[model samples]
Target: MDVRAAACRVEAPASRPLDGTVVRASGDSVAVRVAASRLRALGCAIRTGGAPLPPDAPAGLLRVERAPWISGGHALPECRIGWSGPVAVPMAGERDVQAACGIMHVHGRATGGPRALRVDYASVCAGVLAAQAVTAGMLALLRGGTAVRAATSVAQAAALALTQYVAVATTDPGSGSSRPEPGAERTPPFRSAGGVRFEIETFRAESWLRFWTGLGAERSAIAAGWPPFQQRFATATCTLPPGLQAVAAAWDYPAVRRAAQAAGVGIVAVSDAGTPLPPPPASPWRLRPLPTAQATEEAPAPDGRPRTGDGPLAGIRVVESANRVQGPLSGHVLGLLGADVVRLEPPGGDPMRGVPPMAGEVSARFLALNRGKGAVEADLKSRAGRETALRLAASSDVFLQNWAPGRAARFALDAADLVAVQPRLVYAYAGGWAEVLPAPQPMGTDYLVQAHTGVAALLSPPGRPPAPTLMTITDVLGALISAEGVVAGLLGAGRTGAGVRVETALADAGRLLRDTHEVGDRTADATAPVVSDLAAMAADPAYAALFETDGAAVYSRAPWTFTRPSDHRREEP
Candidate 1:
């Protein structure tokens, strides 16, 4: 189907602002054009080839087109991109809004395994970059009160989408036995207690033992009945024989909650959230650019490049007090630009640093997202730590966190609280679900978001159980969205010299996944299934061209490249 036709089939909410340009094309072009459509909406002027900016075009113009290259062990169609001002483009858009989004489960040698879902990660990455560019452009406009020219290519956006899955590392200790057996399928681990079924994820053997003990049940009975591979789900059934019945008979959600809370275990009642979800912007993810304050000041980078700092975000200071992959990834990407990012961790450091697949004290996941950022050790719970963080916030352009609902307020890190101190700071939050949902305060994770938002259901095959996307898909998207909001908010602040609050919820991202894929009778137009799995995706000449090798390892090429460095002048509006 043609890209324009596919876009027409997209069902957007009536209230969604018609803010961006929408381009239509087909076939290989769909991938890039879909992302380009999003960038245009974020306040960018698209250009093709190595073309010079039009005389009338505004400053910070992005010249986007295409090229081809080979490096390392892989090849890819080069999505060459350049920015006029300090950075490329602002990053902002709903994950589900991009047309022709192709999601698939690929099983090939490139996947490193049969079950790995390694679809077009490069495209995902490119989409993320586009969001960043547009966000930056939006910020510049908010600051200078002028529109900036933003550009990107179809191939680059496609490559970015695919980057999320590449070289991903998980802490799950390869405990495959807990996965249900084919013929012995059972209800989800949600067991009925007091006539209510709740999802109790004890994926790990240790967590299973903890739940069992917390319920005052016999470990011996559990050990005797279930094998290593089945222990996680053995308790998932509705009925347990006499020997193993405490969890159901004696324990209710409240009782389990108390014990689990005390023991730091995981449990939640099954939510009834189904499709036809609330309209777009379903998540708390928000972008509010404050009015540029009078006498607003932007500190210069140590290696000064531009008065607005350097690179797109040059001197912007970001304090990232987030844990795990989702929130950190946002800050990491900002650092990749020109932002001065300072990651605040507890004195003991983020627990993720100690997760498996570690190299010394930090894990690959930590290093991957936290790269190019400074670190600070401060416990938010302590008064001294709070004060120190407040100081940091006061000096930063953005403050990002992923604490549970209201936790930030309790800790005096909430937007309202921080805005009092840093009136120009872009306060951002990324979480699992939206606060509007019934279970607003429930502990949310990538898996829980998948399970709760029906993503698992959609991914599930005909008769099998619901399955989650291969990686922390929602988390990554949420992080990227949140980051984009921060930049856009900052841009607005630069203009009005006022701060704004930005939010992105995993639930909202999940909703995007559902909406984009749940088009009734319009699936064919929204996406055309690609048979290429991980190996095929890896070997595809187009996909291969996207990768660049540094002799040691092959990875997705960075989106921004300097063609010829020179001072960029702004055009009069």
Candidate 2:
């Protein structure tokens, strides 16, 4: 699921809680922890022991003088809310309190399940706030008038709690209404999930606009005013490869576009969305589209010729945790195009660093890709390795990793965790899903996608064996598209303040590339055996996979012989 989109529904698996980032206890008396600073900020006083309490509650205390009994499908007596006291619980009495405490469904408890209650962040934050209240207030009253100030503080805290609790209860899951609990140590989602905590500094609306205006004006002046601030931005973009960007593009373009522009750079950074749209005509400056976090200079510069650089992307830094072919070479390409690319390898070094042709100097894969790059080794699964990855992710503008799904998460290198630390970071992923989504083939790969999507099939035939052209040209084509998406996302990030998540599967890319022909029409000519009557008749027989005469060649098929060969081949199967 998308990271940002998760706001409306922080979806997670039934087996795990907190989206696999954290877990929760399944016991009845779930333990909760609240922060002291946050409670004070909410205007509540510490009244008693920092007891573990549930979320979605308000001020007040009642001594439990009786044993528990069943009522309203529950085993606890109830207390319904009555008078609105400044320092009283919203739903008082033991009965109602017990019910609300357990079944309130405060944050759309149905969004998830037992896992929800377990790692459920609500119980934690709300519990913490309540703990502070009990301690501050109860302590003050029992400690005698010596702690009157604490009682007043508790009242103040209760007021804040009322507003916040009401906000939580009434606010729709989809609406991003209230900000995080004010003065929170970290954002709510982060606090709930216990991931990275980003320090935030607020900006007044007018002041924020002024900063952008000043920055835009400065950039416009720097460019010598050829393209106005708006004009340059209007065309600025980043290109992404087949990766995460593909998934992101499935969203509303306007929202994505707006999100990009807000990122402040000319491009947006997202996982590569494999689909490539035709680009706008070239101007003095070119815009790389998102999928690359913050658009990078894929093409050297606008100098009409590639120049050795000290320019923006000239020495920019990128840390790649990629492996084998696509992922590693992607970073290599960035370095060749002039960004500083650092390759993270396993203890044995990148597999590519030894892909045959070893001259003890240049490995085959490394020769073609890893030029002008450096390497380091780490076991991403270990604590030390993850720490290294974190350090690199924090410092780099782009993080490239090509592992199977769920692999990165185990290492905590998933999009959510990384973006929280650095929003400008562009993440790239390349994988294939034959089972998850429908595809022409049951197994997805460059060769299979091309073959099943008609690229290879078009070039091969029934009577003849399937064969792909040398050099994996089809894969390269998809890779190029993937690379472009990466750049586009980065550009979007440069323009917008938010980062994006993108994905491109081999199966999806191959099908997209083959969409040029009319689909679902039997008569439409789609290269080779699929061609229409006239085109098929005129096509080269042997060359086009049609039955041919005995000559050293007329490539066009003899329809008569072709029928027999095609049938015979099918019969043999």
Candidate 3:
């Protein structure tokens, strides 16, 4: 869920993302051509191989076209959005239009049609978009207005020679490309909830009862037959919150739940997100970033080369069945920390292989999130792919995949299927549609989810037109979140001899993150500059009067714990 888009929304100073509906294609390329008015309103810009490309047909481009809207009184081969400020792509032409698009080029090797090449083409489109968004901030090269855009792709955009891109990969099952209203706070949140719970299926949640398995059954025999079964605590200790104990002692489930909800607390009654989860009064566990030791890096080695560390995860092994950014990148991060992450790609070298690339030896599109990891190609659709994945899972402590919803099950990568074979294994995922595990055919990605979840709306604040950020913000965030579950699940399985399966839907993370009021669609943006932005603006005015054209001076007392360098820019990093 893209929660950021939920907080604030204002009329577009310009309009864009003009209902660029995608249609069933014949083969390779899809086109995007919008009206000059709508395109200009959105402040939309298209760049190919680096410089600006005309919407009609940029030179050196393999394919280019526009989309048509029979309902909105427009028609074309593909669709394009006009320009607008940051956050949210306002649609035009049709009141509701949803299209999934991609590009295809005629290289004389055409073996399929548009729908057939959809996955491959879509991957390329997403890769390019992700790449551009990574380095989208160069827009500030415009003299004075500076926007700090940060993420993994700056290197890739240059490689691809493209500037910006967007995709509407998915829509709610019942939704029909309905654009957000003018005054609505950012986009509507695809997932929204507060005080949800996740209860582990163990003695910890056994109410007042305790499970003393085997030699540890200190109190189990006596408690097993106790008249008050829930209160039986023989071997294992039972812990509960002070508030919950009083309520439970009085047999008041409703009261306890009410109090917990009022306190903004999550209760886990069952492991399922849809179940009536009520946490058994245990204090929340410490939440933190899974420890990471730099996997690879440039350092002051004797030869000034990259270095590797034999950190805590030196021998840990993982298999990645993830595509694009969300899932595979997590493997990259883990690989950086000394984990042996084996990324499994389906035949065509992972959809990202052809997305785009940066200059130099490496392809830009494939470079952003895969600095450290091994690649293994397999076809789940073949006799070999399924066997390879299963074999890999058997030996892996963790398996991660983000192939939409239903796709995983079709490939037999779902948590239940994998856990049955590898009980102590951890399964991590990043996806949408609010399902922990679903069929994979669902069209889902950062763009559409950002729209549906309202995250795009949040990047831009009040009185500002929403902008679809170039960053796969939610994907990155979801990676981190999923990593936590993976680590914890692994730890639990190790400690309890149980490889607990863990699931994290994009929608679930979105709702959990939306606990604050500043989310997209939930709150109107305050339309004020942040403190840092304000401070930078203020500091600039003062600095201009004191600095010379060829000289620089930063006024400040030396830190008590440090000494100033001879030259500000001379310090070695």
Model 2's alpha-carbon lDDT is 0.33
Candidate number that wins on TM-score, 1 or 2? 1
By lDDT, is 1 or 3 better?
A: 1
The digit string of per-residue lDDT tens for model 3 on 358-398 reads 22333333444554567889998776888888888877767
lDDT of 1: 0.49
lDDT over C-alpha atoms for residue 363 of model 2 = 49
After best superposition, candidate 1 residue 206: deviation in angstroms?
9.0
Model 1 lDDT per residue over 396-487, tens place: 77898988777887887778778777776778888776643565345677656766677666654457545444345677666766776676
Instruction: Give the candidate number with the greatest lDDT.
Output: 1
Worst ten in a row by lDDT for model 2: 556-565
Error of 1 at 186 (Å): 9.9
Per-candidate Cα lDDT values, in order, are 0.49, 0.33, 0.33
**Candidate number with greatest TM-score:** 1
Point out where model 3 deviates above 4 Å: 1-309, 359-361, 435-442, 465-467, 517-573
Query: Please, what is the TM-score per model?
Result: 0.63, 0.36, 0.38
Judge candidate 1 at residue 517 and give its lDDT. 50
Tens-place lDDT digits, model 2, residues 139-241: 2121121111111112121122122122222222232111222222111101101221111011133332332343233433223222212121111111112
Q: State the displacement of the C-alpha of residue 208, model 1, in Å, after optimal TM-score superposition.
A: 5.5
